[model samples]
Target: MASMDVSAQVSDEHSAARGHCDVELTHGLIITQDTIRIVDNNQTRVQINQGNQLLVRGQWIELDAKETEILEQYNQMIRDTVPELVELATDGVNISLNAIENVVSGLSDKEPEVLKAQLQYVEQALRNKFKRGDDFFYIAPQSLSKLDDFFAEEVSKKIHTAIQGSLGAMLIALGDALESREGNIEERINDVGTRMEIITAEIDKSLKKKAEQLALKSEEYCNCLNMLDNTESKLQKLVPELADFDLVKIKSDLQYSTH
Candidate 1:
């Protein structure tokens, strides 16, 4: 593999400032200071003055000295479109929750906490989506931090991993809370043991599935590492193969690998 190099050039003639990097992008460009700019495969670019303005642009939107027309258009879209999408998301939960509850009820033996946990999860997830916060995915731009740009090719992938992570975190917390309730159920009726066992079994099954997935990825990652540097990864190798890997994390390995 031929190593890549990157540097910057400025218009100044007398004393030119320069910096070099070995950074690689799957489908994007990163220009370092003297004015850093990154252009994605889709031709969307993020330009920064290293400290001042950051611009993310792709396609024209007429933001110059335009009018109240565009402002009103965006405001209308935010009011109409945002709530419609929110309601749709909530409706989706309602439908899925009904189905899940139906199945849980069959096995629930009228246990209150079981259904409570599921409702709480759905309600809380939806609630978090609407509230303005650091974690909330805000649609309306405001005085909050903005993403200059994200490599477009990874949007679907990023969403998938994000949802998977959110679900995993919710399950871990729900399982813990339910575990406590299981004890109270035990004291009330010995038959409660069966239902708790059922709930625990379900949780364990989900957790196991997640673990298996992680293990598979870990194995693949180890194989990828071995491909990059067999001597370094031999002791750490776990996976026998890999489907594919990307260069996003290569620079992270240098310090530790050198040590």
Candidate 2:
């Protein structure tokens, strides 16, 4: 992974300037704010717009009552979940920031402005990826991929730099504070270490709860994908050209794990 020069002055504009890489999906679905597009094995394209208009092979197709009902059902499903998904993502970001703050609070009194800035950047990135439009939301495989990269590359670097710059000062301050207390310096240091471990364990437990929630949500999402699969199967029966086009295979790329 290539590293970008992150300036000391962390700002929203700077974070926005470091735009995400383009993600290409040769196959499967690509969902945007108002459209859902699928590329099949034979390179055939299928698109459905917000108006429930279906397009295939560069031509718009007229839908019967049943077909229109299926499309409406799918659209309703997505609409209902969009807010819930946004809430979950927001909760995840809050959980992460709280965990970081907890750890920092255990170490020092100083605010972790840099770390918080980076986390805010992450939150904004997530919001952008899962943007809600007038009547729809976006969901693409690349959203997860981009977030993974943000954490692994950008966030990790900022965290490492922050720790390196502050850890020694934090330790010295902690040591001086503890020195005035009863116990020997070494024993007090050990006690502080033990307390830090306990704090870390508590943070881990909280994170696990969030993970469980995410797992449950992933199951619901998988169910939705299955319904979409069934809907597409019905659509294929109605439109023979789409018989070979597989929209649900995008679920495989999702790799949602209960574990």
Candidate 3:
């Protein structure tokens, strides 16, 4: 079993686009091929496993004779949905990486080896969050936060480094410009410096735009997972035993709220 935490902050646009109020995941969910486990803050554990098995607080629950019908219905729903969820998650990772690559590739004609390696690391990190073994796949709660950090922090840092590295080529161009002019070296130097500032500003503007795009994509991915919370709600309603047990809770907060 693998575990991770995922958090998503919705933008006004995202909320409007989905036609729903902002939502957040209050607790993490551990999803496997045949089971979904929710561990609350108080260390209370509730799990729904294959074959209509339910465990609460580490004890197997015995359903009433009439409850068997509800159990079977829940099991069938899970059996129909888990594979689709896995497919959607896998696709989400691929789409995110492609988005990152598109942003990073714009930095230079030929992408730096360092950036390529960083991308690989990111892919591996994301894949690690979704554990797939011989017979099961798992989605941990931490995966969304990792995704957010990858684009917001790690990728942003790499982009800045790569952009700064390109300044060396600019300096070489400055040298060539200075060599071609013989008089007024100080004036020429100042002129080159001003042009360099302009170039730097342009790079910064481009970087900011790319970063915004990445941030939006990250939020979009997180928003997609909101469906999982909806599923959890449905399960609770279907199984009376789960009425008080929150398999997954999503809450909305203002700090990460987007304009």
TM-scores of the models, in the order given: 0.27, 0.49, 0.42
Compose the digit string of candidate 2's lDDT tens values, residues 4-100.
Answer: 3333333333333223212222244445667766655434387778847888877888988888787767655645544565455445545655666
Number of clashes recorded per candidate? 1, 0, 9
Best by TM-score: 2
Give the candidate order by descending lDDT.
2, 3, 1
The alpha-carbon RMSD values of the candidates against the true structure, listed in the order shown, are 19.4, 16.0, 12.1
Ranking by TM-score: 2, 3, 1
Residue pairs in collision within model 3: 4-141, 4-142, 5-141, 5-142, 6-141, 24-250, 24-251, 25-250, 26-249
Q: On residues 175-258, what C-alpha lDDT tens digit does candidate 1 reach at each position?
A: 555676745533443443345446445544443443344333333333233233332132112211211212122334321231
**For candidate 1, what is the lDDT?**
0.33
Total clashing pairs in model 3? 9
Candidate 3 runs further than 4 Å off? 1-17, 21-34, 39-44, 78-82, 92-117, 142-245, 250-259
Model 1 clashes, total count: 1
Judged by TM-score relative to the true structure, which candidate is superior, 1 or 2? 2
Global lDDT for candidate 3? Answer: 0.52
Model 1: which ten-residue window has the lowest total lDDT?
143-152
